[model samples]
Target: MAELVRRAGLPVSAEEAFAWHERPGAVERLLPPSAGIQVAQCSGTIRDGDRVKLQVSFGGVKVPWVLEYYGYEPGRRFCERQIEGVFARWSHERRFEPDGPDACFLEDRIDFQMPGLWPIRSWAERRILRGLEKTLRYRHDTVAADLAEHARWRDRPRLRIAVTGSSGLIGSALVPFLTTGGHSVQRLVRGRSGEHEGHVVWDPETGQLQADRLQPLDAVIHLAGENLAAGRWTAERKERIRASRVEATRRLCQSLARLLRPPRVLVVASAIGYYGDRGDELLDETSRPGRGFLADLCRDWEAASRPARSAGIRVVVARFGLVLSPRGGSLAKMLTPFRFGLGGRLGGGGQFWSWISLDDVLGALLHAIMTDELEGPVNFVAPEPVTNAQFTRTLARVLRRPAVLPVPAWALRIALGEMAREMVLPSARVVPRKLEQTGYPFRHRKLEWPLRHLLGRQTPE
Candidate 1:
C-alpha cells in the first residue's frame, strides 16, 4: 500500500472550515483544473454510503471512478473508499482539527494500491503522490483564501441581495457563493417569473421591476448586458450593446432609487474597455475616459448609476477585465483552438490585456458588497498585466503546444470589422489600485495559476 498525507492551515474554526466544504460548488472548486476530471454524479454528502462518480480524461482515453463515503463525522473527519475505479484499492480521509478560536488545520490522508497487473508499482506510486501533492495544495490554498475572504465580514448581519444576470456565468457562480455564505439571493429574471422563492421579473427596456419586491434587498448587483463578442459589431449590434448597458443601467438605477427602502449598495459591472486603446498607459479608477465607442458607452453606462447615488445609495462600478473561465468568456472561445495547437497571438501581440479569474471577479463583487468604504469605479483585475504575446505564450506553454503563428492586425480588422480594431487590438494596462488599497486578496493573482487550473494543466511538483 502507498500512503500520502498533506496538511494546510486555515483561518477559520474547525466547524467553519468543514462547513465551507459542504456548500454547493465546493467539490467543483476543490477539483484541480489540470486533472482533466469532472464530477459525473454525486449523492448525499460526507455521510456514510454517499457516492461520488467522476469522469477523468487523459490523452484520448476517458475513465470513470466512483467512491463511497464512510466513517462520517461532522467538523472532524470523513473517509471515502474506492468502490469502482482505476486503483485496485483506495481509501482517503479528511480531518479538521481546531487550532484556535478562528483557525484550524486540515489534513488529508490517502492510501492506495495499483492494479495487480501493473508491474512497476513504485513508479506509479511516485507519480500519483506528486499529482496528489499538487492537487491538495490547490485545494488547501483555495479553502484558506475563501475562508479568509469571508472572515472580514464575520460580524456583519446576513443580507438579501438582488442580482441581475443571475443566470449568466458570473451570476450563476455568485448566487451560490452568496447563499453558501449565509446570505439570501434574489434573481431578477427578464421574462415570466418562476414559482421559486427568490425570483423577481423585470423589463430593462421599460425600466420596470416590481418595486414592492425590492424592499427587502440590502444590495443589487447588475451584470446583465449583451455579449459584445457574440458576433460582428454592426451598427445595430453596436446600438444594442449601448442600449443594453447604458439604458438598462439607467432604468435599473432609476427603479431602485424610487424604492421605499433603497438598497444600501448598488454594484454594477463595467469593463476596462472604458480606457479605450491607450497603448501602454497605466490606468486606474481615476484615469480619464479614453475615446471610442466602447469607452464612451462605458462612461455613459457608469453615469446612468447617478440616480441611485443621488438617492443615498453607495454605488460601485466594477470595471471588469477579461474574465477567465473555461465555462465562458474569451478563454472559453479560445480553448478549442488552443487545445488543437491552432492558437497564436493577435495583431503583433503587444497590446496589454488586464485579466482576472472568474473566482476573483466573484470575490471582488462580494468585497464591494461587504466593504462600505469602496464606492465609485473599482478596477477588477489581477495585479499582473500581461501583453498579448506573453498571454499566448503562457497559454501555449500550459497546453504544451507551440504558438509560432501570429494573426495580423489587418486580418482581424477584415474578419471582425470595428470590434477587431477596438476590442481585440486595444491595449489597456489597468491596475486594481482601489482593490489593493482595500486589501482584497486575489485567490489567483497570477496568470499561469488560473490558466493551469482552468485548463487542468498539471503543475510540476
Candidate 2:
C-alpha cells in the first residue's frame, strides 16, 4: 500500500480537537460537498469502534464504501480501515498532540491501494493523494480557523453560558452563532451513573441536577430533552419522554435558584405541540396548552423552569415549530423519498404546518439571547404557515418530482398509532407575534424561498 502523512495544527485543546473528530456522522461532514457523500449508516464514537457506510462521489460516479474504525484514543489518536468496497486496501490514522497552552498539533497518515493493476494503480494513487492533500488541507485550515476564532474570544468579557444537549441538532447550530456573537458556552454533559467533575450532571428520573456548577452566568439556554417522535409512545416511552423534559427542567431551574450569581436569562425550548390540534386557530404565545401527552409534557416543562424565574432570571420559553434542514431532522428523512418521486401529502393535507428553517431557528435563538425585551413565551416559527398539502407540493416541486398520492389519516394511524395523530394529523397554525413584535426579522420567512435555496436553486432577479 502507498502511504501518505500530513501534519497541521489547531488553536484548541486536545479535548476539543478530539470532540470535533468524534462528532456523530462526521464522515459526511468531512467529505467534500462535490463528493455527494450520503451516509448510509454510522455508529459508535469516532474515537473508537466506529463503523460507517457511505455513498461517495468519485468524479461523476457514486461509489459505496464501508469504513471500520480499528483503533482510537481520546485527545491523542485514532485509526480507520476499509472493511468492504472500493479500495483494495485502506487505512488512516489521525493524531492530535498538544503544542502549547492553546494550540494543538494534528497529523493524519493514510495508506491505501486502489483496485487496479500496477501502472493504473500507481497513476490513481498519485491522483488520489493529490486530491486527499487538497481536501485535508482545506479541512485543517477550516478547523484551525475555528480554533483561532474560539481562542480569540474565549476570554472576552462575556456570559458564561452553560447548555445541556450542546452537541444536538439545535445546540450544534446555535453554539457557533453564540460563539461568533461573543458568548462562552459550556456543555452540561450527562455523565455515567452520577456526576463528573466540572460537569453539571443530572438525573432526569430523580429530578437531580448538579446545581453547584451553575453560578454567575449571563444566560442559560436549556435545549435538553428526549426526542418526542423517535418511537412509539408506549407506557415506558411516555414516562421517559415526560421525565426527560419535566425532571430535567426542574433540576436545572432548581440549580439556577441556588446559584449565587444566577444567569440574566434562561432560554428554554418548548414545542407548538403544547397547542395540540389547533385546527385553524391562529395560536400565539398566549394560547393555552391543549390536552395530550406532548402538550402536558410541554406545560410541565415550562412550569418546571419557574424556579429560575422566581430567582429573578429572565426566563423565555421558545415554543419551536417544525425545524427544516438539508443536513438532518425530519426534512432529511424525507429528502430521499422526495428525490425518488415518492413524496405525498399526509392525512387530509388540510392540517396547517408551522415550520422554520434551521438557520432562522438559530437566528431566533440568537435574537432571544441578545434581546433583553424578549422575555416570557415566544413562538419560534416561520411567518408563513402552510397546509400539509402545500408542504408536500412545494417539496415535490423543489425535488422535481410528482406528489399525487395522499396518505390517509386512517392508514397513518394504523401504522404509527397515536404518533400519527399527534405528529402528523394535528394542525398547529402558529404565528410568531411575539417574535415579530420585537422586530426580529426572519431569514427565511416563507417555505418556498428557503426550499429553493436548500435545493441548490439560484434565485432569479
Candidate 3:
C-alpha cells in the first residue's frame, strides 16, 4: 500500500478543533469548489459505524466513494475506510493532537493502493499526490479562517435562525456555515404546510406563513428573489424581478411584524445595483440611490421592510456586489469563456466592479445576524474595488490564460440590448463600511488569492 500523510497546526485546542470537524458542514466547507464533489449521503458527526457517501465528478464522469467510520475517539482521533470506490484499498485517519489549551495539530494520514499493474499504479499515485497537496492546503486554510471567526463570537449565544431562498447560492452556503457554527437553521421553503417535511412553510406569492413557527426564532434572513441576469430585460421579466423583491419582501415583513414575538434581527439581501452606474464613484451605505430600474427597485425593496423595522426588528440591508465562486453566480458564468482564454474587459475597462468572494458574503451575513450594531444599508463588497481591466488581467493570471478578446460596447449592446447597457457596462465602486467598523473578520480581503483558493490554483507559498 502507498501512503500520504499531511499535518496542519491549529490555533485552537484539540477538542475545539475536533468539534469543528464533528459538525454537519465539515465536508461541504472542506471540499474544493473545482473538484465538483457531491455528497450522495452525509453522515453528520464522527460516530462509530457512521457512513459517508460521495461522488467525485470530473470531465463528465462520476466515481463513487463510500467511507465507513470506525476508531471514533472524541477530541482525539477518528478513522474512515473505503468500502466501495476507485482505490483498491484505502484507509484514512484524522487525528487531533493537543499542544496546549490554545493550540493543536490536525494530522491527516491516508493509506491506499491504486488499482492496476505496477507502471499504471505508479503513474496514478504520482498524479493523485500532486493534486492532493492543493486540496489539503485549502482545507487547512478554511479551518483556520473559520476557527478565527468563531473565536471572535465564542462568547455569544447560539441562535435559531430561519432563512428564505435556502436553496439559492448564498442561502445554501449560509445554512451549512451557521449549522457548523452550532446555530440551528430552519429553511423557509415556499411550499404547502404539510409539504415542508421539516422546513418552515412560507409562500411570499400568496403571503402565507405560520407566525407561531417564527416566534421562537432569533433572526430571519430574506434572500428570495428572481435572478436579475436570468434573461434580457423584457417587460414581463422586469415585473417579475420587481415583484419578487418589492412585493415579496413587503408581504414577508408584514407577516413577521404580526408575529406574537418576531425575531430580533432580519437580514434582507440587496445588490450593489442599488447604486446604479455611478461612473467611478466610491459608494457606501450613506450614499443616496442613483437613477435606474435597479436603484428604484432597491428603494422600494428596503422600504418594504418598514413593517419589521417599525416592530423593532434590527433590519440589516446587505447590498452585495458580485459574489465570486465557481459553484454559482457571475463567476460561474464567466468561468467557461475565461478558462478558454477568451476573457477580456467590457467597454473601456475603466468602470469599477466591486466584488467579494463567497466566503466573505457568508461571513458578512453571519456578522450581520450576530452584530446588533449593524443596521440599515451595508455594502458587502471587498474594501478595495478593481477596474474591469484589472479584474480581467488578474483573472487571466490566475487561470494562466491570455485575455485578448475584449467584448466591445456596441457589440454587447447589440447582443444583450438593455441588459448590456445597464448591467454589462455599469460601474459602482463599493466598500463594506459597516462590516469594517464592526470588525467583521473577512475571510478574503483581496481578489487574487481568493480566486486561486476557490479554483484550487494555489501556488507554493
Q: How many clashing pairs in candidate 2?
A: 1
Residue-wise lDDT of candidate 3 within 1-461, one digit each (tens)?
77889999988899999998888878888888887888888878669889989998868899899999999999999999999999899898999999989999999998888999999999998888877888888889888788877777889998889999888888878887888788888888866655544487888897788665553889999999998888888999999999999999999998888888789999998888888899887788898888788888888898899999999999999898989989888789888999999899888898998999888888889899989888999998998889889988988899999888998999989887888777768999998888999998787777898999988896636
Best of the two (2, 3) by TM-score: 3
lDDT of 1 by residue, 200-314 (tens): 9889999989766554789999999999889999999999999999999999999998888899999999999999998898899999999898899899999999999999999
Clashing pairs in 1: 33-456, 34-456, 34-457
Query: Candidate 1: which stretches are off by over 4 Å?
Result: 1-5, 32-70, 79-92, 109-135, 195-197, 210-215, 458-461
TM-score for each model: 0.85, 0.68, 0.96
Candidate 2 C-alpha error for residue 77, in Å: 29
> How would you encode candidate 2's per-residue C-alpha lDDT over 204-253 as one tens digit per residue?
55656566654457888899888876878889998888888888888888
Give the distance in Å from residue 243's predicted Cα in candidate 2 to where it truly belongs: 0.6
After superposition, which runs of candidate 2 have C-alpha atoms over 4 Å from their true positions?
1-157, 192-200, 207-215, 455-461
What Cα-based lDDT does every candidate model obtain?
A: 0.87, 0.77, 0.87
* Residue 306 in model 1: lDDT: 93
Clash totals for all candidate models: 3, 1, 0
